[model samples]
Structures are given as structure tokens and as C-alpha cells.
Target: MDAFYASVELLRYPELRGQPVVIGGGRNATPDTLADGTRRFKRLRDYAGRGVVTTSTYEARALGVFSAMGMMKAAQLAPDAILLPTDFDSYRHYSRLFKEAVATFTTQIENRGIDEIYIDLSDLPGDPAETAARIKQAVRDATALSCSISVAPNKLLAKIGSELDKPDGLTILTAADVPPRIWPLPVRKVNGIGPKATEKLAAIGIETVGDLARADLELLQANFGRTYSAWLVEVAQGVDERPVVVSSEPKSMSRETTFERDLHPRQDRGELSAAFTDLCTRVADDLRRKGYEGRTVGIKLRYNDFSTVTRDLTVPLPTADAAEIRRAATECLKRVPLDRRLRLLGVRVTALLPAGSYIAEPQSVQGELPFAPD
Candidate 1:
């Protein structure tokens, strides 16, 4: 899963293997050539619109290209970098291969994303460290891909442990190993800490884990609200007891888009309807690809000022067709106030069950094909 999308591009076009490659918007970008034989340099911020960097190769990273950065900003950093489109279907195939490889050792596998996983080694062979090494080796042998394995007393340390090394990393931590290794890092490195928490921690001189460890729980509670404050303290002390969850289920599937300008549904009925249909098709495609079916079809609307609302309808049967989903969602849309100017619109399908899991009723609407949306 290393530089996943870009790596796949490299495999497809072996010529790009050693170059600094980036995968983002569909087109491959290079320096703009002028008639005079001079090339123009581009900055990522200088590029247009909503695209985000999906992944970039290590060489591209050295040029300040990284994932989730704005595509335009990345173009500015490495304009001559080879750009490729994201091939998620191919990525998913590799994901299944790697997961199936790891599953050979233990069923206690947790997928973090397309690139990472957590394997519970305590229940497996030899020392946990030795077991981790073997697992890493086995994965490489199976897929020709290297992976980092973190073996720890618990999930928290293991999560951080897996990341300490990159490309191929292995870290082992015990309950007693927290302070020296984990404390010096920024509080932001802790799983739940986000931009807001880091800013708050910085305000109170709690920039590092050590500083947070010395913080008063009550003061943190006052700042972060009770639930999050308690979690912060536990993180500081490496007190995570959360079990490594073996099975992961998709809770919902959704699609949303932001428009260039606010649009009132009543004022722009044609445009809004088209966008809604687009979202439904995308979500339905996702459901089919993931082998999932949803009992509920829902719509979400974010007004011009960003206030949001959602409505849903429960269908008698789960489906993965775009037209059926769009029809169901349109019914849900009737419950929303269309007069409000909208900034965003989303469609979601939830209450999911694995595809083919349901038994159809014998008589009512038996095997009826879903009607196509207009």
C-alpha cells in the first residue's frame, strides 16, 4: 500500500517508477511549455478548484508534495512531477490480497485504510516482537509490498508504534515504555487530537504529550468538555484499554458536493435535481462495489449559511441501483424546505447489511425490478 495510487501507476507504466510521481486529478501534469522552449513553473495554490492530493511518491514528498494537500499547491511544489489518476478499484484488489495474507496468521486484523492494518500478535506464536517480524516478512513475500507492524500491550501504543517507521517499520512497546518514546512527541500525534485540540493545548503550554501528562484534568475538562478531556488524560498516560476490534462493518455510505455558489433548491430546481441524481448514482455505485445494501435512503442539505438538515426513507428491500436509490431519496427530499439557499447537498444510504444476506418475502412485490428514476 505504499504510495498506493501512484505506485499502481508506476506498475502500469514502468517508465515512471523512479520519477517523482503524484496522483490526484485525472490528468498528468508537467511543466507548461512555451513556444520559445521555456517552461513555466506551477505552484499548487496556483491551480484551480476543489481537487486534493490523493498520494504522492517519496521523491515527490521530498519536493514538499504530500497527501491531502491542495492539488494546485502541490503543482506549485513539483510542477514537473508526473501526475496520475487514482485507481481505487486496483487499490482495493491489493488491499484484499494483503489482508488475506495477514489473515493467515490471525483473524484479529484491523484495517486502518487502504495502506495500513493492525494485527493482534499476542494470541499468535513466539514473542510478540518475533511474531510481528514474521508477519511483516510473510506479507512482503506474499505481495511484494513492505508493511510496518506495531506490537504493543494495547491498541493505543500499537497505533503509534506502527507509524514510527515508514515504508517498512516495526516497533514494539510495553506498558512501561510510554514516557521516553511517546511523551516527547506533540499531542497532535495522539489519535484523537485534531487542529482544534492542538491549538487549545498550545494555548495552555501543553504542546507535547509530557506537558499534557502534567495538565490538570479539571482544567482540560473546562476547555474540551468532559468527555474529550477524560480521553485526553488517558492518552497522555498511554492508558488506552480499547480492544483491537477484529470485525469492521460499514455504518453508512454517502456522497456530497460543494457548489461554487449558494443555490436555493426552489430557485434552481433543475441544477439541484441534477446534482442530487449525481450523488445518488455515486453512492449506489459505491454500495455495489462494496457488496453492501442499505435499508434507508437519505438526503442532506446544507443551507447557504451552513446549517444542515437530513431526511430519510426506509425501503422494504435493500438495493444497489442508482435509479431506485434516487427515487427513494427524492421521496426523502420532499420533507426538506427547498426555499433555503444551499451550499451543499448529500445523499446517504444506511442501515446496511451485507449483499445477498436478506431473504425475500414470498408474495409481496416478489423480485420486482426497481423502477428507473427520471
Candidate 2:
């Protein structure tokens, strides 16, 4: 899916096509419809908040705006860009449609995130390019959105190759293409390499995949340790043996939000209390929808200074009821200090058990909440 969130919004407001648009505003960003049958959208400069970019159109990307970047910063870069609120419900709907469409070709797909998947096409009998094109068309037909795809010999190459072209793209890679195609790219282009690793690699003059490939094994070992160094070397050589997992159980479910303004614990208790309640309710809804209950409930808090804290409590039994989850999370909350203003809040449920595995019984009453709702 290419610029998935923004593309979905484009379907609703085709007038905004070809323009730099951003998605991440609160519900207040919803466009107003005028009597003239025209839509009035908010602009990036009009945005004043702490949320990060969820996704942006390629036009906005060209202006240095991208996902997870500060909304204020994005405003400075693309102030005239159209701003829209986040719509996860619609995004998830199209996600299902696209995945179902692809299932018609092959079922050996590893679910990645809302917009990406790792597909095993080795058993499919077809030209790789043609097959990739068909998949792209299927996605567009099913969701009215374009998606870029790649058919590579391995996941590592496939991941990198998919983005080589933009909008709607189809790329094919073979083992013979690694040196001429992949080696010249920066080490940071490799998926698993992070900022820290990239910085260390730069210090040693190993800036590209080709450089890493020809680096001394002893030098790599001295810098990154034997296990990681060996792994890095193999990665440089385009070696990835991990199989595509068809399915797996989730370890936990959580919901969090960064605030538009730093919220004081004591001064903004009303707002923090509402946000905390909303997070708990949302997490509970997610658990019930997925047919799972959890024994552990937790809360995460990030201070205005960017420091963080988290605490969890194990209940007597797994449960997905909103009130139960909220109460347990409140217990976890009291164990931490709220002396500083908060920038973010989150609630999580873990130690999951399938809801159908056991009968949900009543929970024992606990003491009154030690603090206010937040």
C-alpha cells in the first residue's frame, strides 16, 4: 500500500489528489462541507499539537514530511499541505480487502503490519513480474489503492526492492542482482540495522553494503561482538534464511496517545482521567473483539521531559471486561509517581488466554482506588 492512510483519505476527497496531504490530526481536523458542495480542509500551518505524522502523500514526503515526525515540524516543512484526521477503522477495512484479494493467489502470507505482508510465492507457477503485477492490480481492484510489490529470492531483498519504485511498482530480484543492485546501497537501507549500528558502521568507514561485505571480520567482531558481527556480514552478503511465518498468536494488546499539550498530573487531572479511561476502554474492546482475555494489566507514562515509566499487575484470572482492566491498571498506576507533567499515556493487557478457553467468572472486589481516576 503506497502512502496507505493518505491514499484512503484521497478516496474520500479526490479533489485533494496530487497535493501534499497529511494524516494525523485529531477528529477536529475533519473537513467541513460547504453549501457549494466543496470541502474545506485544514492546512498543516493551522495544526498546533504534539501528535506525530501517521503518514503523508509522496508530495508531502518530497517536502521532508514523514510518519512519526512531529506535527509541528511537518507544519514548518509543508505548511500549505492539507491536514486530515486519522481514520484507523477505514484503514483496517481496506487492509482486510487487500489481504483477502492476495489470498486468492497464495495463502502462504506472513502478516506484517496494516499495510505490508511477506508472501511466499516459491510454489506459485508464473513469471515473477507478471505475478507481481497481478497482485498489484488485485489490490487496486479490491481497495481502489495502489501498492508496490517485489518478487525477490528472499525477504530481505524483497523488502528493499519493493520501495525501489514509487506509487504502483513491481520489482524482481535474483541472487545474481545482489552485488550490482543491493551492495551499492547504504547499510541503513537494510531493515534490521538501526541508527546506533549505522553510526558505528560509519565510524569504521563501512558506509555501504559493499563496504561491509569487504570489511575485516576481526574488525567487525571487535566492534559488534562475534554473534552480531557474523550476522551483519551475512546480511551484507544478502543471506537471510528465516522462513515466512504463516501465522502467530499476539503477545499483548495496548493503546496509547501523545498529548497535544503537556498535561499536568494535578492540574490536568480531569483531562488525564478521561484519556486514561478511554485507553482502558479501547484496550478492552480490542481484547473482546479478538476473543482473548488477559491476566496482566499495565500502564505506561511518558513525562514532558521524555522520561518514561511503566508498571503492571497480575489479576487472579484473565478477563477482558473494561471495568476489570481499568481497575487493575489503576492499581499499577498508583505504584508510580505523577509529580511531573505527562506527555503520553498508555494501557496494556498481556498474559493472554483465549476467551473460549475458560468460563469468565466474577472478579473479587478490590479496595477503593488509591488516587483519582487518572
Candidate 3:
């Protein structure tokens, strides 16, 4: 699933092949039909909104446009790039097609979101590389799309190997290749090493996987917690014991939106309130559709400057009522400092339980609420 969203768009507009394209615009960004019946797509230069890049083609990436980048900043880098609104339904359709195609080879597969997965091929007979090639061909046969595949002894190395090459890449690795292939890479390339941890590692002169592997255990534990430090050491040596999760349950459900224009909390209180309620309703609808009820309601706010904050409140009973979710989310919002104009708002439900297991009660009980930065 290389440049997944953009590649899917390319399938729809073949004429735009090899050209810079971005996906993130709203409905109005849809291409228009010309007098000659040819389609005219929107250009990034004309985009003026708070929308962020959902994905960009490799051509656009070369021009410095990337996923999660503000559309305005991306426009500054590749103003002439074609802009297209996201079509998630089509993406999901392709996702299902590819997964089913892969299932033809093995059912011991772990779905890692819509674009990626981990397959347990150890039990399967034949050369691992050949098997991966067959799987990749199956996906292309099913969806006419290309995907990168990595075959390694464990999940960690496999995940990193999959990213070593570009579109339609196939990489194979073994424990013997760890020192030569994985050691020199940046520490940030490790799965669990995030930005904050990477910065801390850099400050301590541990910038590469090799450095981390050689770092003192006590030093790493003092910087990171004991558990994370030990895990880091194990991963640097290409030792990941976690098995592929064959199935998973949803931890939370959420709905969020970025406004076309930033809205001041106080000045646009009425409008904001309506949007907030609508978000809660959507979250509740999602919970019901998924047959789950959540006890924790949370609100997320991203200001004009792109800083985000989240707050959550737990209730005594699990519920999927829109009004109840709205009430809890509203309470969570009160704990946040809304001094700046907000560009995005979101509502989330967590601590989920099966909808059939919990029955709504008339009694109201409040639980502990906490504010956290997201």
C-alpha cells in the first residue's frame, strides 16, 4: 500500500499518472467536467483551508508535501500539484479486496489497520520470498495496486524491512542480518521509538540503532522507564517476542472534523456548540452501529497553532446515548483552556463494553475526569 490514497486516486484518474497529486481536500475540491467532457481537477495553489494532507503521491513527496502536513504549507512547496478530496469508501473496498486475496495464501494474518498487515508464514511451506511474491501478486491481481512486502524472522524486523524499499518492494531478512542491515539505521526507525524518545536518545549521544545497542542499560533505564528501556535493548538486537495478533477488538471509537475556518470558542459559541453536539451524535451512532457502549467520553481540541488537548470523563455506567455522550463531552471540554481559535474538534468514546452487556439506567453517577495533552 505505497502512497495508498494517492495511488487509489490514480486508478480513477489515469491521466494524472506520474504527476504530483495530494488527497485531503473537502467536497468542493472535486474535479469539474469541462466543455469537452474532460475532467479539470483542483490545484493545491487554490486551496485555502485548515485541512491537512491525508496522503500524497511519491511525486508530491519529492516536492516536500507529505501526509499530516498543513495543506497551506504543502501548497507553498508544490502549488501546482493536483488536489483531490478523500474517497474513503473506495479505499475500504480495495482494502477488503486485498486482505481477502492475501487470505488465499494463509489465514494466520494480523490486520494492522486498513493499509497494512502481518502474516505468520513460519508454518507455511516453501521459500519465504517466493511466498511473499505470490501474496503481493494476489493483491495486485485483486485490486490492480502494488504493495511492499517484507519477510523477516519476527514482526519488528519485518515491519522495518517492509519500509526499506519503495513502491512494490520485497525485502527479506534473518537474524544474521541484524548487525549489517539494521544497526546503522537511525534510532527513530525502531517501531516504539517515537519523537520524544528519539530526542532523548539523541541528547544522550544514542542516535543510531548501533548506539542504542551499545548504550548502558542503567543509563537507558534512567532516561526511559525500566520496561521501555529493556524493550528497546531487545528490539535493537532484532529480538521481538510479541506474536502476530490474529484478531483485535476496538479500544475506542471517535469522530473528528477540521473546520474550514478557525472558530473562536467564545465568539462562535453557538456554532461551536452545534458542531460539538453533532460530533457526539456521530460517535454514539458509531458505537451503536458497532454494537458497543463506552463509559468514558472525551473531547479533543486543536487550536489555530496546531497544539492539541484532550480531556476525558468516566461515567458510572456504559451508554451509547447521544445526549449522554454530549453531556459528558461538554463536561470534559470545561476542563480545557480555550484561549485560542480552534481549527479542529473531536469527540471520542472509550472503556467500551458490549452493548448487550450494559443496560442504560435512569440514575446518574459521575466518575473521575482527567485532562491530558494529546
What are the Cα lDDT values of the candidates? Answer: 0.80, 0.91, 0.92
lDDT of 3 by residue, 1-374 (tens): 88888989999999999999999999998999999989999999999987899999999999999999999999999999999999977998898999999999999999998899999998899999999999999999999999999999999999999989878999999999899999999999999899999999999999999999999999999999899999999999999998999978799999999999999988998888888888989899879877999989899999999999999998778989998898788788878998899999999999999897976768656554343222
Candidate 3: TM-score? 0.86
* Candidate 3, poorest ten consecutive residues by summed lDDT: 365-374
TM accuracy, model 2: 0.95
With candidate 3 superimposed using the best TM-score fit, by how many Å does residue 32's alpha carbon deviate from the native? Answer: 1.3
Regions of model 2 farther than 4 Å from truth: 358-374
The estimated TM-scores of all candidates read 0.81, 0.95, 0.86
| Steric clashes per prediction | 8, 0, 0
Give RMSD (Å) of candidate 1 vs. truth.
4.7
lDDT for each residue of candidate 1 in 82-190, tens digit (9 for 90 to 100): 7665676778777788788888889987777777776666667578777778878887777677777777877788878777876688887887788999998898888
Highest TM-score among the candidates is held by which one? 2
Superposed by TM-score, candidate 1 places the C-alpha of residue 324 at a distance from the truth, in angstroms, of 1.1
How many clashes show up in model 1? 8
Poorly placed runs, candidate 3 (over 4 Å): 266-274, 303-340, 359-374
